[model samples]
Structures are given as structure tokens and as C-alpha cells.
Target: MDAYRGFVMLLMAAELLQFHRLHEAFPSSVLWGLLAYHQSHVEWAGCSLHDLIQPSFSFLVGVALPYSLASRLGRGQSLQTQFSHALRRSLILILLGIFLRSTHREQTYFTFEDTLTQIGLGYPFLFLLGTTRPRTQWIALAGILVGYWLLFVLYPAPGPNFAYEAVGVPPDWPEHYTGLAAHFNKNSNAAWAFDRWFLNLFPREKSFLFNGGGYATLSFIPTLGTMLLGLLAGQWLRAGLPARALLRRFLIAGAVGLALGLLLDVTGLCPIVKRIWTPAWVLFSGGWCCWLMALFYGLIDVAGKRRWAFFLTVIGMNSIAIYCLVHLIDQFIINSFHIHLGHGPFQVLGPAYEPLLTGAATLGVFYLILLWMYRRRLFIRI
Candidate 1:
């Protein structure tokens, strides 16, 4: 678990590298292109490694829940106490997400599209689900996906004259704008519609419109489903299944989920969109998450190959600290590097390589801090 969480944090921390700049500098270079593509979010349909960060983080939360509840119970904690802790944690996550979003704004931002906010919104329900039996958990998962899909399908798709241009979708956009697929189109789905009304309820300087990135607050619903997938995996891990059996389960999940997601996308029953957390996407990303859990579990837990993963475990132990640090001080660290290291320190590598050099230096600072925290056992938990 530490290794997996650390791996995800490593991905987040690496964002300081500004791989996109590298891509722009070397559009023809396959290495940069691949790195840039994986590091960035996909526009509408499809997925990317960057996109997996949220799901993996959320999934890890679910993966940890069974153990969390168990630890509390083992300590003879009351149900009420556990419930209160969960509630407190949920509120912190939501407020922290808003606070982070409001970094440069004059007032608090109530956005729910961020990973923390989405997890916060769905966490209480997830806790309730955690108390249920495995069969009940599966039933809840199915209901969320099916119910969310039904809501989108029942809502009428935008008509031909629906003015896709108004929402930044070009009239000739390649994604489908008809049938079931249309129900999940960018900035026109049921989730998007809900945000239009919901976000307006909050005080804002300007009227809320479409999210420029096409994200919706209601994605948390399907995001819950993604966590449920992790909950099942967690339950399995706790079940004391044979190692081979656990591995088999992980592989099967990946195969089934990837296959089903592709099937839905191909058949146009629903599109695989990460922005809105379409049901297909829940299954799609959930599959990859499962495989990742298996791989990391095998290497770190099963095989006992612990030395190489030391750094990842360090970052993972202080995941929240690293997350907040990266968002809060990225620029400060980069500027500090420029100020002390000299502005033209990286010019020898060429003009386009400056960002890469500075980004690498920023990442070095981040890791050193994390290492210091790890040494002192100063993990900052919610």
C-alpha cells in the first residue's frame, strides 16, 4: 500500500518537470511526445497517466478504508467515534480543496472537480458502504454506475441547434453528439447541466457557465463508483486469499474492465470520458487501478523486494504533505532555483531545455523535503 501510494505521489510530484514544454520544444521527438502525452490530461474522450492520478489516489483511499476501520475497531473505538473521525476527515478534504482552489482568488472557491473535493463529497457514503457485506458493496457499485448512466440517458441529448459552440465544442467536433454517446458529450451532459444550476447557488462574481475544461461537479457520483471498485480490492486483500488467487483476480479485473470500456466506447452505448467520470470510465480506469495494485503488491509485499522502493515509500508516507507542497510552492522553488542558480544556468542545454532543468531542480527540492519528513516520521495525515 505504501509503495503504490508513493508511486502515485511520485507522478504528482514529477508534474514540476513541465514535460509539456519539452514536447513543445521537440514535437518530433517520440520520447518527449510520449512523456508529454502521459503527463497531461486528455481533452474529452480517452485517458492518460496523468488522469489516473486522481483515480489511483481515490482508489487507494478506498483500499485503505477496510484497514482503517479495522484498526479503529481493534483499538476498541466506538462506532460514533469512527463516524466522527470520518466526518471530520471529509470536511477537511472539502474545505482544503476549496482553499487550494482559492489560492490566488480573493474568496473561497467551492469547486468540486478536484480529486480531494470529489473524494470528500462521496466519502461518507463510501464509509457506509464499507460497513456492509461484500455482496452489498457490489450491489451498491452496480446501482451507482447504472443509475448515473440512466440519468444521463434519460436527459435529452442536445439537439442539432443546441449551440455546441456556446460551450466551446465546435460544431464539427469529432466526438458523437447524437444517441447515448451524445448524453456524455463535453459540457452538455446531465452532470454539466447540474453544475450550471448547482454552482449558481453559491456566491460568485460572475455567472457560472460551462467549465472551460469540461469537468463537472457531479463526476463525484461516478467517482464514488471508482472507489467502490477499490473497496472490493481491499476486501479481497483482507480476505487472506492465496497469493496466486489474488493475482488472478487482479488480472481478470483489468482484462474485464478494459474490454468492457472499449466495448462501450465502440458500441457508443457510452463514451469513455474522464472529465465527467462516465460509467465506462469508472470501469476503464478501475481496471488499470486493479492491475497496478496487483503489480505493486507483488513487488513490495509478495516478493519482499523492498530496497528499491524506499524513495517511493518515503513520498507515499507523506502523500498529503507532498500534494499540498507541490501545489503551494512549485513556483517558489523554481524561482528560487533561478535566483540562486543563475537565469542562464540551463542555456547550455539549449533554450527549450531550461524548463526541464529548472523543473528537475524543483523536483529535487521536493524529494529532499519529503526525505527529511520521512526521516523524522513526520507524516502529515488528515
Candidate 2:
């Protein structure tokens, strides 16, 4: 399920990027719709389909936790051994995330701010917390969210005064909070220097001590909540409930999550903002994750529809490979081939065709490579 979703997301991203590149070649609405779907990340505030992507990834981590742990336990692994394994896995993921973040033309060392790193850093804490009784996990999850809210809300710097009063503040106030956090953490990329200078009140030198408010920190709390929910779902799924019962539970949970999120947003206690990973953001994004899981569970596990599942399963099975491949392809292969469609034998095609045709061809080539690997049973795991 995880690999399948990841593959779908990657293809969606590629299709969106392709459509964006061909905006001028297609109808305005079609182009704009694709662009909107691709542009899922919230600009600085509020929720969008784009914002759901990362949360979905985190949610899947949670969903898989129960099954993975049970399998380990079945193998006669002690609790400590299982935990050690989880910790090791988390560390590897974090390192990989750091590798991705620092894989720049100029960088030579790891950085700890990327999504994978955040997940890697966050997951062990979650696993440790989750290993307790379910009720205890729920309490811990709630405690984390409430504690985070209190910490940021009452924190002397970056809240109420600095965040509330900042002029021309980005819609996502959390970005400013991250700036404050980056100041203290001093783990930021220089590429974002201009963004820091203009949006944040304190200069890098002065406010370096106060940099930890944005989505990254909030992620610590709400994401834990997300993982908790996933754990809960995993537990429920593993309890041998009937398919209909599971589906009903998922729908009910999703509805409740969405309702609570909306209510919180309406009350202004927590705005549905992804950049900040606000509490409302948690419920909203989590609702979507639940819905997707329900749908997939029904379609694949319940319905026994395995034909279409293979594609996503392949990508899912070797998701990390696919992610790295996509990135490398975009950075090196596709960019290197500046096909001049209007020259020589390709003279008939215009400049506009270059982006569309080239992008399609490149994507097709990569997809085929993935397909071939899948057929040959060459699943890569890390």
C-alpha cells in the first residue's frame, strides 16, 4: 500500500510537472487544473491538495507500523530488539533524507531539514511512544499536540508579538516561525538567505538563537498525532474486523476528523494550515489519508483487484529507488537533453512541442525502466 501510493504520487507529480511545462500548448483550464493539482504545497498558510502529500506519506508510516511490529514479534524478537530495529530504520531514513537535502552542486555535508530527515527523526520517537498501551499512545499523542501548542503559543519569541504584528507577513505565519527556529537551530540552507532576510524581522546574525517555530517543529507534535491515528487504524485493521466493519470505521473516523478539523478552523483555535502543521491541519490532512487508506484497502485487499495494483506496488516496493531515480532523471538526464524539435529531422515540430514531447518521452523512458525492473523481480529495498 505504501509503495503503491508513493508511485501514484510520483506519477501524479510528473504528470503535473509535464502539464505545467505544456501550459501554453494546451487549453487554459486543463493546464490550470493540472498546475493546481501539482501545486499541492501550501504557499505559507491554509490547506490544499498539495499539502496532503507529505502527511499522506507520514500516515502510511503509521499504518505500516502495526503489521511490521507484529511480524517482528512473531519472529520472537524481544521488544528491545524490535525497538532497536525501528530506531536503526529511522536513522537510515533520516540519513537518506539528509543526503537528499545536501545533494546540491555546492554542498558536501548532510543537512537535517528535509522531509525524509524529519520523518526519520520523528518516527523513532513515535515508535517508542506507540509501543506503550494504545490508551497511553493516545494520551502521549494528545500531550504532544497540546504541549506543542502551548510551547509555541506561549514562547516569548516569534509568537503573539513577533508573529502577530509582523508587516506583510506571509499568509503562513509558521514560515516566519521556522525562520525564528532556523535562527536557533542554525541548520538552514544558504539558498534561503534572501527569504529569511526579507520575511523575518531579525537578521541571521541576531536571531540565530531563536529559529524553531514553523512546520518542522509543529510536525513533531501533529505528526505524532498522525502516527497515533495510523497506529490506531493498524490495530483496528489487525483485529480481524469484517471488511464492511472496517470500511464503516474508516468512513466514520474520516468524517469525524474532517468535522473536528473544520470546527477548529471555524473557532480559530487552530487554522488549517499545512506549513505550520497546525492541529486543524492534522485532522484535515489526516482525514484525507484515512479516506485514501479506506479506498485502497477496499479496492485491493477486500475486492481482490490485483491487476492494476502491480504498477503502484512496483513503485511502492522500491519507492526510495523511484524517488531518487526521478530526482536524478530530472536533474541530469532530462535537463541534459535539450531537444530542438524545430531543427533537422525535427524541424516540423515547433519550440512549444519541445517541452511537451521531451517531457513525455523522458517520463515514458523512466516508466519503462521501472516496468522492466518490476517484471524482472528487481525490487530494491533500503
Candidate 3:
């Protein structure tokens, strides 16, 4: 779990790499183009490596819940105490996410769609569910996905004459779905309408408009579904199935999830939109998360390959600290490098490689901090 988590955080920290900078430098290079694409988000109704980051992080939260509950109970913690902690943690995560979002703004951003906030919003419910049986967890997951889907389907779709530009969608946006799927189109769904009203309740530079990226606070609902999937997987891990059985379970679950999500997308019952955390996306992204867990578990635990994962374990153990470090001070570190060492060092290989090199140095700085914490056995838990 630590290795897989470290891998996820590494991907997040690597955003400093800004592979997109290579677009102009290697316009025709397929590998670079793929790298650039994976490093960024698709406009809508599709997936990318960047897209998996949030789900993977959210999924891990659920994956850890079984263990979290067990550890607390083992230490004689009461259910009331656990509930209080979960509640407190939820508030902190939501506020922290808002704090992070507001760093560049004049006031608190007041958004709940951030990865941490999304997890925070649903964390308590997840904790409550943690006390239930595995059958109940499965039911909760189904209810969330189906209920969210129905809510979107029941909401009125945009009229033919509706203005797309009014909601920040481009005039020529080519990803718009037609027919039933139109209900899930960007900035025009039930979630968007809810945000238009919900977000305006908070102070802002201007009236709450559609999110430029079409993200909505209500995404936390399906995000909960994603987490529930992880919760189930974590329970499976705790069940102590033999190595081969666990691998088979995860592979089958992953394949089923992928197939079902794609079926929903192709049949137009729902579109897989990560921005809104659609039901299809819950399945699709969850599938990938499970497969990742299986791979990390099989290789690290089953194959006895522990040394290779030490680097990731360091990062994974300090995930929260690094998240804050990267968000709060990554630019400072980047600037320090350019100021003290000068751009010449990063540009040694030519302008095309400068972004990658500078980013690598910044990432190295992050890793060193994490390594220091790891060596000292320092871990920041919620």
C-alpha cells in the first residue's frame, strides 16, 4: 500500500515536470506527446493519467479505512471517539482544501470539489459505513452510484436554444453529448445548477459562475462511491485470501468494472466524466485503482521485492506532508534553484529540456525532505 501510495504522490509531485512544455519542443514525437497528454486533463468525457491521480488518492482513503478502524478499536478507542475524530478530520480537510485553493485569490476560495475536500465531505459517512458488514458496504456503493445517476437523469436537460458560452463552455466545444447523455454535458447538469446556487451563498469576487473546468461540489457523492469501492477492496485484503486468490479477485473485479463503465458510456446511459464524478467514472476509475493495488501487492508482498519499493514507501508514509509541501512551497523551491544555481544548470541540455530538469531538481528537493522525515520515522496523519 505504501509503495502504491508513494507512486501516486510521486505522480502528483511530478506535475512540476510540466511535460506539457514539451508540446512545442517535440510536437511530432509520439512519446513526448503521450507524456504531455497524460500529465494534463482532457476537457471532458474522457480519462488521462492525471485524471487517475484524484481517484487513486480517494480510493486509498477507503482502502485504509478497515485498518484505521481496526487500529483504533484495538487501542480501546470508543465508537464515539472515532466518530468525533472523523468529524474533526473532515472539517480540517475541507478547510485545508479551501485554504489551498485560496492561496492565489483575494479571499477563501470556498470550493468543495478539491480532492481533499471531496474526501472530507464524505469521510464521516464512510466511517459510519465502516462499522457495517461487507454486504452493507457493497449496498452503499450501489446506492450512491445508482442514486446519483438517477438524480442527473431526472433533472431537465438544456433546451436546444440554451447558450453554452454563458456557462463558460466554448462555442465549438466538440465533446458535448447528444440524446440522453446530453443531461451529463459539461456545466449544464444537475450538479452545475446546484453549484450555481450553493456557491453563491459564499462571498466571491463575483456571482458564482460555472466552474471554468466544469467541476462541481456534488462530485463528492460519487467520489464516495469510489472510496466505497476501495473500502471493499481493503476488506478483501484483510480477509487474508491467499496470494493467487487475491490476484484473481482484483483482476476479475477490475475487468468487470471496466466493462460495466464502458458499457454505460457506449450505451449512453451515462458518460464517464471525471469532472462530475459520474457513475460510470466511479466504476472505470475504481477498476484501475483495484488493478493498481493488485500489482503493488503482488510484487511487493507476494514476490518479496521489498528493497525496490523503499523510495516509494518513504514518499507514501509522508504523503500528507509532501502534499502540503508541494502545494505551499514548490514554487519557492523552484525559484530558489533558478536563483541560486541559475537557469544555466537546468538549461545545460538545451532550452527544450530546461523544464524537465528544473522540475527534476524541485522534485529532488521534495524527495529529500520526505527522506529526512522517513529516516526520523516522522509521519503526518490526519
Candidate number with greatest lDDT: 3
lDDT at 268, model 1 = 90
- Scored by TM-score, the top model is 3
Q: What is the C-alpha RMSD of each candidate to the true structure, in Å?
A: 1.2, 6.1, 0.8
Which parts of model 2 have CA positions greater than 4 angstroms off? 2-4, 11-16, 23-31, 108-111, 156-218, 339-350
* Model 2, global lDDT: 0.63
lDDT of 3 by residue, 1-382 (tens): 8899999999998989988888769898898899989998888988998899999999999999999999999999999999999999999999888999899788778899989999999999999998999889899999999999999999999888889999998767899888999999999999999999999999998998899999999999999999999899999999989988998899999999989999999999999999999999999999999899989988998898999999999999999998899899988988898888888988888999999999998899899999998999899988
lDDT of each: 0.89, 0.63, 0.92
**Higher-ranked by lDDT: 2 or 3:** 3
Each candidate's clash count: 0, 14, 0
Q: Which regions of candidate 3 deviate over 4 angstroms?
A: none
User: Residue 83 CA error for candidate 1 (Å)?
Assistant: 1.1
TM-score of 1: 0.98
